[model samples]
Target: MTIDMNTLDKAILNRIQTRFPLTSRPFATIADELGSTEKEVLTRVSRLKDAGIIRRIGGNFVPGKVGFVSTLCAAQVPEEKLDLFARTVNTFPGVTHNYLRENAFNVWFTFISPSMTIIRDNLAAIAEKTGVRRILNLPATHVFKIKAKFDL
Candidate 1:
């Protein structure tokens, strides 16, 4: 069943959609900005998580600008070993996200290398570990920049 959010949930999500304030007490600041208390925001975040509306709360290294090289790689993991292969590949320090896509290459993941050499070496290691002879390393061709928010 799909979960439908009410007004408060909408408000909470809107607060999240905006760039979270950069402050030592971010939750407290969010509470102040949203006309609520820190405990309220924290409780709502927990409720959202429990309701399966929010997956995670974390930050990432500034992509590209931080000398973090990244590329999209796909592998055709044997249907039975898909999970295992994905799990093994995920063990890499540089992998950021992984997915099971509908394309011929079912197991797709985003890998970031400290450098190009590490990227190649990590791919080689993943292939060896997974016994996946066929792999596609599609380096980024073009990045279409877009934003997720709009100003009304």
Candidate 2:
């Protein structure tokens, strides 16, 4: 059965938001924090993943510190042109996540680059290959927190 999102699901997600401990008894630490048994916590996390409520459990990283620049780009593509546009956008290096959002600029993606100039060129190449007349490059001036464990 597909699991519906609920309170226990939220707790499982909350536990994952923080780093998973590295110790001989890490599960005990997590259990203490979540008011759950170690086995229960482990089972619930696995169940959520199986049911597609939790996609992954991991830490987010900083790109510049790791010698790369990361940013989000939202591109405006013509509706009749999704396939052609998606093919071009998907070809760029450093594109990790790409999704279609229902808005003016629908093709939203995150990208990483070795330098800032490469970001400009990458967007340009996408535009050229897709025959886009206008493209918006909004490299993140300030990244924001978009992740939170919802109190389902």
Candidate 3:
């Protein structure tokens, strides 16, 4: 699963992991910083994304400041219904991250919504729909380190 990346690819990955210009033409800005053309930057980024080097490109907002609350949810899904349960959970707009683990509570995800009520309702609906009885709702108790930077 080793992907051979060129200098530009490595530079793009490393640079973007820390700072991406907040501009209308971000790729153009990156191109300027990298001594390359906008087209070249865009094309290389597209190739990187297509090759699965980049999972996503978006903004991260502070939940409380932006009128949002987030929670971590876990469900003990049976092996037979894992696929259906995951697909159903993914339908919610607020469900940002979902994962399958090798544990008693095998399914986990993070969700964000305008209020705790909405978050609870969504979790209840998911539980009822999927016939999953035991769901652990873990809300953030404190703020800690939350950053992902790679020097690739």
Candidate 4:
């Protein structure tokens, strides 16, 4: 779906994509930066979210530094059970992101936990609950670069 965003929306997206304010009222900070009222900024953000332009708004942390373990998991779920499988995976708080792709391993997600044992146990429970035959748990061995910024 395509959204015809206005200049304000574009500005908001560009500004908030990477460096969001870490203040008590972050939206108010954003409003100040954009020369908009806090209510206006909040309303625009709400509209963007309603339009699916914003999938999520949250914090991202370095797993290793924070005493947390993160992994990329994939499962080849049958088409008939894809919805159920995806929903099952979403129940876990550690399952941060889940997606359906066009490959043998059609389901993919990122899971973060305090330890590898917790992640493994959660995956095992997920497999049991979803009745998926196989789930590939791929931990990041090395990262050349990682960036999550989109230019508007």
- Highest-scoring model, lDDT: 4
Output the lDDT of residue 6, model 1: 67
User: Which candidate wins on TM-score?
Assistant: 4
Output the lDDT of residue 150, model 1: 32
TM-score of 1: 0.75
Cα-based lDDT for every prediction: 0.77, 0.77, 0.86, 0.89
Candidate 2: tens digits of C-alpha lDDT, residues 1-152: 58766765577676666677877877678888878888987888888878877666645677776888888888888898888887777778787767799999888888888987999888888887888756676676775666554544
Residue-by-residue lDDT tens digits, candidate 1, 3-51: 6666666777777765877889888988887788899888888888888
Residue 41 error for model 4, in Å? 0.9
Q: Which window of ten consecutive residues has the lowest lDDT sum in model 3? A: 139-148
RMSD of 1: 3.3
- Backbone clashes under 3 angstroms, per model: 0, 0, 0, 0
Give the poorly placed runs of model 2, Cα more than 4 Å off.
Answer: 5-8, 24-28, 32-40, 77-96, 116-135, 144-149
Worst 10 residues of 4 by lDDT: 140-149
Q: What's the TM-score of every candidate structure?
A: 0.75, 0.59, 0.84, 0.91
In the range 22-78, model 4's lDDT, one tens digit per residue, is 999999999899899999999988899999899888888888889888899999999
Q: Model 3, 43-67: lDDT tens per residue?
A: 8888888887886787777787798
Model 1, residue 85: distance off in Å is 2.6
Worst 10 residues of 2 by lDDT: 143-152
Clash pairs, candidate 3, are: none
